[model samples]
Target: MDTLCSRMLLFLGLAPFMTLAATPPPTHQFTLDNGLQVLIREDHRAPLVTSHLWFKVGSADEAPGQTGLSHVLEHMLYKGSGKTCADEASRILESIGAEENAFTTQDVTGYHQTLAPRYLGVVFELMADLMSTARLHADDLAREIAVIREERILRTDDNVDAAALEHFTALAHFANSYRTPTIGWMHDLQRVDAGELRHWYESRYAPGNAVLVIVGDVTLAQVQPLAERYFGVLQKRPVPRLLRPVELQLPGERHLTLHRDVATPQLLMAFNLPGLATAKDPHTVHALRLLNALLGGADSARLPKKLELTERVLNHVETRYDERTRGDSLLLLSAELTDPPQADLDEVQARIWQEIEALRSTPPSLDELERARTRLIAQQVYARDSIAKQARELATFQTIGLPWRLLDEDARALAKVTPQDIREAASTWLTRERLSVVHVQKGGGR
Candidate 1:
């Protein structure tokens, strides 16, 4: 009934989405002699276009001392670059009615813009300048660091949920660069100077370490020349592959109870899992995606159905399993508790583990498995409706060592996920030893 209602909502204009076929669009992919890869997809549906520049460098690449350098450089690019200061960059784009922003993730830092198709050359020039001539001015670095520190206060220090996630992930991985937050520690940011920023930038921002994604209102015939003219001039140097520390094993179950001033308590559990880039079994990833959908949403979801129908202490349950990473990642399940809880937390944990063990032992019924795959397919269709998101998706795949065609392959692969695969994946990857649990406490209580 709920699934039917959701489809009804989709038909009633409450949901807008897209599902590109496995074939994808007619994208022209090529590389420059300077080592930059470019993907161009033409969409003449609108007069708008989005240009994305993805640097294949992120927090994972940062050494112990240079945490958040990728994010810091993202801010510095906006503070100003080359001769086009932030003001000038803003003025230039604003004059042409452009929307622009940049973000850093675990495996990639990307800058993007959506603007009139005619402004493609303009963006190319702006990005090319930043790529080569970023000033990393001392005053600018200090000011931005202050801005980021305040951001930290709001996002991590004051927000207990965010703080808990930080500590949870740190303890979860224990020994990899993934343990560090993308937003570097306040102390590290305080000490990072222009020279340090410049060094990180120059080393990672080379043409060899980048992918340019263009979609909408343009073709490669029109974009290739401008790309060459603006970006081709940059020097070609082999991108230094950073040493990636492998997690040989989880030492044991790790747990943290964070006490802070808050209105309610929350519980989070995560398991270390292989990423799409590094996974030995691709089928497990597809099965995991279906498994997350089946276990996360709707009244029928495993977490909610068991806990909620029984009227346990949980106010809500959410499970997220994103396999997009350059290395190991996680399958995370989190829940918010009803205040002044009536249920025993240990009992709740036991029940949750039981559901996991069931998945490992019994293959889900065919109907349930099909429902999970259907929801997964429908959501993907809805997620790629925006030209900007499409371009971003393209760049992200390349950055994470995933082929662009994987986007199309996903729908096809998801359909092939069998119940047996889910059982095996749950049993193999979601073991007790790989799990880390975090409890958020509102006050001074165990």
Candidate 2:
């Protein structure tokens, strides 16, 4: 079970970074009187418009006992507001030939709508209404809890990869809020009644904690009046400043083994690394991303080519550097063992380490670095093809207190990384002392 879980983590860790090559629309940004930040990106290529509302709060902001408050609040936002009833917002949206949805992640919660440009005001009104006046009625809370429970079951319980990643994170950040699942522990959810949810909503869901992002066929001058009329008049509430506790730096490697019903062996490894916020650190995060690409990101990456293609000891492999929401991030490497014997597993692990050591000792050839950079750049260009992606990118940055301009900055940074930088990053951050390994195996020992 441990081995299988680790392999699953690897698969997820290496999922493609979507890219879009087409030129993005011209964007304008501003702040409302009540401290709500707004960004407008004008694109006349299509008559449709995308509206996104990003809240600064998410899973990491939740209080200790209220594990999934941000996620639960995301669902409840659509339940009812000042003038809308449970699910009525969806009905109205569909009636106007629009699509709308919301999602919550570790760092932010977002609500979005895409519709013909004419419906922009309607979209804004609906979003503003919900943001200021969501009603967490008892019956609605009760019904949605069941829905979310099922969602949790489907995502974390039924799916092996998801379960393993969740467990891996839990163990990886033992002292941090990131350790908890965003969907929350089932037990925690049971205790989150309507009153508790309402308290959470009142405290965190305020204009000061939000940002509005729009893309498609709208200019700053055109949308500013409507935005002011709809969103500006809301009374400001005193939102408490976020104070994230610092985590003690991990000094050495940590290992854990988990058992579950599974078909093959898996290994999950994570190493602590500095986050993107600290500029003086030489952008190890980006270099680690490049390292992940060279090691196991693509079909022809080192792990796949060596383990699956040549050695035939592993069926698949994956590696990634998670750009964290808060505090330090992680560089993860995961793999599946073809045969589950202890000796073989140990040997496979050694080979993985050997590959890392080689990369650390010797800079990648110009060709290898260029190829990985090209692939990464191509993926970024592809992800920008849709207005949805543009909106998501902006929301993600704003949610994490980063300037949306960082998107371009990151592209430039990725371009500037040298092969020597990759080697240095690997040696410094990917050291064995900073590593944690999780192995998933079958229930009974061999």
Candidate 3:
């Protein structure tokens, strides 16, 4: 979320968006005549509002050779629309003293602006204008392609850690477009023309396929009129919801080792697990949450204790899992090697598997499991302290095909997870046969 990453924030692949909290967010929902759905929450805390537009299309929807079109389209929408000169959108928002940004995920693409409550109309009109009339000029598309291509190179080609993660994720999945990068393949991006972008936009950026989320010091009555006036008349059509694929279980463990010129070695392990909204068993979702917090969600977790302080083999480690993904969830454990000679890469790798084995064989103590549960709950409660976070979480859930009730539902489910439940999650979901390991080792090259 820095100067550069903020604009290109979608490329960062942040740990995960939104925390599972106990208290459900307050939201008012309505659909326009043209099928555009709108959700608004009145927060009189300050005279400010956050306006968001989420489209139900992302990387997974892309066909081969057309990857990254969604993200490229996101950039062009910001470039400008009818009667709005190039970059004029930003100038107008800046004049109003507002903040605007956007990002693309595996399941959705979103654009947002935070400004005064009085400026709500301005934001709405601009968003509608872009959605309806963005001019995908050939010159503009050419410029943006070059910019996005540079971004792909900086984030992927020269960056070993990111490259490893991308490859590992694709290999872990049996088959699908999810293996392709959201920023897109360099070859495909070079060939993506204005016509291709316009076709995707016209087909996917319809009112029926979008959701409007507004959070601020405004009532539903006051906002409804504005939404309908600005967004109502758009043509209605059925959204082409992607029929998700069922990921086949990997027959045996999949491992990949990268030998390249690098400063330090890196290790990544991912286990495909149940997603919260898509899981058949509710308990599996909750149990996996607790297990994640216990393992790599915190500083005092197992990876730090076993690999860094106790065995003293590694120094950096982080775990990530998104149970709410549109597709299968991946529980990932990643670590960077320490400098001072401790243990060779082989020994470190063996210890990593041993940690998972221990969790399956022996369930965590009541105290350990309880601590993780309590910590997770606390984090969710604190997440509400930020109005922006709550609104984004609400939009994220709704856009990804999950009901808003999931906020409280997941929290309650986590409370029922016992030590045995955690052990079951490890044994059932964290299978050795499905595990995928990738290592980036040092080699003599650029």
Could you report the Cα RMSD, in angstroms, for every candidate shown? Answer: 3.8, 7.1, 7.8
Q: Sorted on lDDT, highest at the top, how do the candidates line up?
A: 1, 3, 2
TM-scores of all models?
0.92, 0.90, 0.92
The C-alpha lDDT values of all candidates are: 0.80, 0.78, 0.80
Model 3 steric clash pairs: none
Candidate 2: minimum summed lDDT over ten consecutive residues — where? 13-22
Candidate 2, residue 282: Cα displacement in angstroms equals 5.5
What order do you get sorting by TM-score, best first? 1, 3, 2
Of candidate 3, the 10-residue stretch with the lowest lDDT total is 10-19
Compute the lDDT for candidate 1.
0.80
Give the distance in Å from residue 345's predicted Cα in candidate 1 to where it truly belongs.
2.4
How far does residue 335 in candidate 3 sit from its true spot (Å)? 1.1
Question: Model 1, range 1-446, lDDT digits (tens) per residue?
Answer: 57777555544441222234444667889898899999998778888899999998888788787788989999888667666866688678888999988888878889888999888899999889988987878988888899999998899887777888888888888667788788987788878978888888888998988999999989889999999999989899869784443554755688888886757777889888877777787877888877787777555788898776676668888788877777877888888777777565666677788888889899887668876776777766755567887887788788776788887677778867888988888888788788899877778632
Better of 2 and 3 by TM-score: 3
Better of 1 and 2 by lDDT: 1
By summed lDDT, the worst window of 10 consecutive residues in model 1 runs over: 10-19
